[model samples]
Target: MKHPMPALLILLGLAIAPVAAQQVYSWTDANGTKHFSDMPPPPNTASAQRLNVRSGVTTTQAVEEPAAEGEPAAGSGPAMAAAAGYSDADIKRNCAAAQKNLERYEAAKPAEDEEAEVQTRYQEGLSKVQSQIKLFCG
Candidate 1:
């Protein structure tokens, strides 16, 4: 009987090929939040670096400064959403959800006993939802 070792090795190599080809990026946003994702940051993001998945090596790429306050970064907006593998319909759905959350947060009233704690949680949730709105609706 023929040994199956070589065939198994070939199959293993094929299984690893896609993972080897995947890319990871690391960058700090304008708010100084460091992020790592398969998607590259916006073009105007500074200090962007590409990471090798297998070797854990990182290579820095030249990048421009972050966009001005209240302005979207280059390659951001809807295109960035697409690049992040989100379809138009997905973005729309998420945007609507975020809007609903924002409305709920705005209309909510905390109980008098736990008002401070509830208000803090509400503010945090609202900030996250608003950020999502900007990302999905822009």
Candidate 2:
């Protein structure tokens, strides 16, 4: 004996799938003008941005800040920015997360594993957590 509710629910989900399946495309034309289209871009053209046109889905991109005169190139400079203002709860959560990550990395010795990639990742994660603690907990 097979229950039919699960199969009916799955069928209902499939029926409503198309209502949330719209895709949007953004691309620049030959004149450097940006355009958004419902259809995909033609082949051999530049890469286009794609967005899923669903409720509460935003299609926006981050703007890059121009480097100051004394600042180095983007990739060459340190990744950490000045600490931003955070609420008390946010600060507490950040500090706890950083401490937990640091402790986890410390307890798990990468040397016990033979993979160089794992050791490198462990070191990187430990450094990131240390920096996070300094930035947030201080």
Best-fitting candidate, measured by TM-score? 1
Candidate 1, residues 1-138, lDDT tens digits: the string is 398999999999999888867778889988888898998789987789887766566546468688888655666665577679998899789889888988888788466677687878877888898888888877
Instruction: TM-score each candidate.
Output: 0.43, 0.37
**What TM value does model 2 have?**
0.37
- Write down the lDDT that model 2 would get: 0.72
Query: Per-residue lDDT of 1-138 in model 2, one digit per residue for the tens?
Result: 399999999999998887656778888888887888878887666868887877776757676777777653343213222234465567667878888888887888666656888878877888888888876565
Report how far off residue 31 is in candidate 2 (Å): 33
How far off is residue 11 in model 1, in Å?
66
- The residue ranges of model 1 lying beyond 4 angstroms of the native Cα positions read 1-74, 109-114
Each candidate's clash count: 0, 0
The candidate that wins on lDDT is: 1
